[model samples]
Target: MKLQKAPQAAPELVHLEALLGKASVTPLDAGCQPYLAERLEELGFIVERLPCQGVDNLIARRPGVPSLAFAGHTDVVPAGQHWQVPPFQLSELGGYLYGRGIADMKGGIAAFLVAVERALATGHELPGLMLLLTSDEEGEAEFGSRVMAQHLKTQGLLPPWVLVGEPTARSHSGDTLRVGRRGAVSGTLRLSGRAGHVAYLPPTANLLHRALALGQQLAALEWDSGAPDFPGTVLHVTGLEHGDWLDNVTPSSATLRFNLRYSHKTSKDAIDQRIRALVPGDLDFQLDWDRPCEPYFSLFGEAQPNFLTRVERAVFKGLGQFPVLSTAGGASDGRFFSALGCEVIELGLPNASIHQANERVEKGEYLRLIDIYQALLESL
Candidate 1:
């Protein structure tokens, strides 16, 4: 794509450019949160800097019970090699703004800020509003929104509705709004057996052979048929390892690393039980599990018509088309709010280039998002 300078700076673009100037790589706010805090404070918000284990977090709230909260992260993934423009500086090319975190998701943050400013400028009192920002979303995520959610719960400040600015749109801005996310569980399976020469080893003694057989069975196992809003539970064997380097020798042990993206229809305990049943009773094996998160939907029980209807109308008003409600993404911080019994929805710029080299968002789409968010705020 050819590089072209934008004609003029819009408020949201200017904000995004300043944010892109900050090299806030994972676990490092690099002054991004403080800059945002200053702007929010100017809007009559009480900004609190909550740092957890070196990760920067900010919770800015206007007086009153928080009815709507905008949640996002400032930290970005490492800007890898081979970019067409400097990753730390915003560049406009072919009507797209390129920079790290522009789509995942400093762009969303900037748009929301401008939207809030525009909304309040009308001299209309908005419902109780809050902003939750963290600089660790792209890192281990242990100290980001997870910790913020705890603090909110303690202070009794958790909002009834949360809008996470994760890049959920596909083809265009507001095309897809995520109502929920699938849970992710990772596992390591190690099978132990006797090592011997390939020609001399018994079939049962070759752990690699057993591992392959078990892997096939595991891959074929049906977890769940899926729900209307969520996809079916599926397993993917990510890696396989064996100690043997020589072709003639059978390794004594083998390890298989796998991950499962499960829907709410299947429980973690149920998944564990099924995996255990698939293993041969006579085999010596070890199965280890990592921290697993459960799937969550914005509509926990019955659907809340008011909240969903407002969002849909706002999206339609902004884009002239209603968005499709989906729960197909991997995971996001929105789950933190959903866990708190908050109705959470994720909507933002198109995600085609997020986290990739030359990450970018269409300049028009970025401006349009400001309108969408403003409309949503007004409707609420």
Candidate 2:
């Protein structure tokens, strides 16, 4: 048999390979931002490193008006063992690029970088462009985008438009763009009762029983019919616990953990009040809520009101079809910038394998992402 040479990787793959090879997990940058800053600096951007609460953030901006911020994260979720290929090494197999954060975001970041390189090479005068890189998106997100956003707001340096490179596509790379996301609230619910023997249960009403009824009520109630731009509110019981297993004794207290992904039509206080009403008047119970990301929506029509029309047309020019404007996913860092009056939109590769073993992104889709981002830049 004749010997054959193996094909070389694409240039875009080369850039992504270097990024994936870095050991950045959760809140750790693992030196990825320095590498990106070098590239941005070469493009006439002034790079600034902002470290907050042990998390690394980079802001690269070119001097000009009408700034557009391109936001992304360098941090990735932990890559657990048991994968067909090394999770941290960029692997090309059957026309797909596999890595830890390829589908979720690193690939999106790489695409934007490639797009900027191409645009700058062509001598296209881009309006004020800012790259907001953070290392805290996959973690608590406390010292990440929010930190930069607040700092920029205080200095009156907040951009008028922001593009978050979060993986939002469902089936195709440009098939869907997230206009907004529902708000999330999570915490524990506690109920108290007296302890007693199972056989003699007069004074001890079972906290578990009352909690079960409350859980059922919350799950069954229909909060809203969902707005045209948002989804209906829903509550989920994540965990339930009581005293240790004792066949002869009744537990004194019970705790139930829950999360609610509510729409813009619903408020946290409203949901809290509604939950309060479900608990029995005689039961001694308390429900604590943790509000993380609030619900937000961007108006989309022709072009003037929101930037959705221009982005949609750009996506069509790149992918040969318009994308659906949706708000059906979990919250993202985009919400932080949106609160500052920036028109924010999320666009990236399909999210089929994010946060899973052997997370992969299609090679064709990866290339298309670059095209979509470049076209968006030109339009802006």
Candidate 3:
């Protein structure tokens, strides 16, 4: 594919182009972390590499009393079909930079790095600044920031303030900031019933019918009206399956999978109990649950007043617009840090095309994001 070069791009855009050039798909760093580690080391950060079960994690810290931390992922979802340019290569068209991870992340990562570099060049005192990057965040997250957070907790290195570089902006680069995220709980349900000929099996004994009915009941459930910072709890039946392929035979078993994105107004325990209660008494069934994250609000305890104000002020200064505090998104690595008592906020480029074909972000937005991040660091 012929790529159109970015005309006189800034250092951050150049860096982001380099990052997008590497194909670090989910669960694979593809040298992205190593490259970042080298750059960070040159900037006087004490870089630590923590590799867990094939996933790469990096913690780069500047020696000082820790005040702020930046968190992000190096991994991106697979570049699926349909692209005007190579998915792994950075392409410029119509004043936009196209790549797989540019908007979803890598763009944010590059912006932060350049922001740090520029801030340090100006002799800015960013005492106790840290950057946390992981390769497993786009995957199962079994061995990424979750492990890093645990390690930081043990070493008493967890920062009080965390800024996650997730693509949170709705309209422009700094229009919205994610003050919190909704929690997710996913479940796989298996129902067992006696297999029989279609003519002999009654409606009560049909596993498929039972599965569909249960799915409807679960979907129709209304959990809550939600709080001011979050939306209402919603459930989605992701998958349903049965073993039998023959049309005339009733399947002996059926399986249903579902997920719930709930707000802070509800607890995981409450969702779990409510789901269990919905199961019929006579059905032979089993339910397995996976709680990936819990909802968190941006409350800094005793530090709330100064820390949040600084962030908001920096954003406004950089973008010429005050950002709206939002809590409307799926779970992210920020949830882990928030759970560990850090006041977490997510800020980055616009997210309109993330995880979609031909993903791209405006070059201007990318450049401005660097200023916003730099301003944030300087404010600290």
Best by TM-score: 1
Question: How would you encode candidate 2's per-residue C-alpha lDDT over 1-380 as one tens digit per residue?
Answer: 22222134666666687788887998999989999999888889989999998999999988887478999999999999878887888877877788899987899999999988888778777868899999999988999999999988987889887889999998778889888888899968899978778777753376677778777877788888678767888888898899787877778888888898888788888988888888888988888877567777665435573577778887898889999889987779988888777888898999999999989888889999999999888776
In candidate 2, the residue pairs with backbone N, CA or C atoms under 3 Å apart (3 or more residues apart, or in different chains) clash, namely none
User: Model 3, 71-106: lDDT tens per residue?
Assistant: 999999999999888899788998889999999899
Per-residue C-alpha lDDT of model 1 across residues 215-303, encoded as one tens digit per residue: 88888887786778778889999888988578888888899889999887887888888898888888888999996877887774355
Once fitted onto the true fold, the runs of candidate 2 whose alpha carbons sit more than 4 angstroms away are: 1-11, 196-209, 244-250, 300-305
The deviation in Å at residue 341 for candidate 2 is: 2.5
| TM-scores, each model vs. reference | 0.91, 0.89, 0.88
Candidate 1 Cα errors over 4 Å, as ranges: 1-9, 196-202, 245-250, 291-293, 300-305
TM-score of 1: 0.91
- CA lDDT of every candidate: 0.88, 0.84, 0.88
Question: Which pairs clash in model 1?
Answer: none
State which candidate, 1 or 2, has the greater TM-score.
1
RMSD of every candidate to native, in Å, equals 2.5, 3.1, 3.0
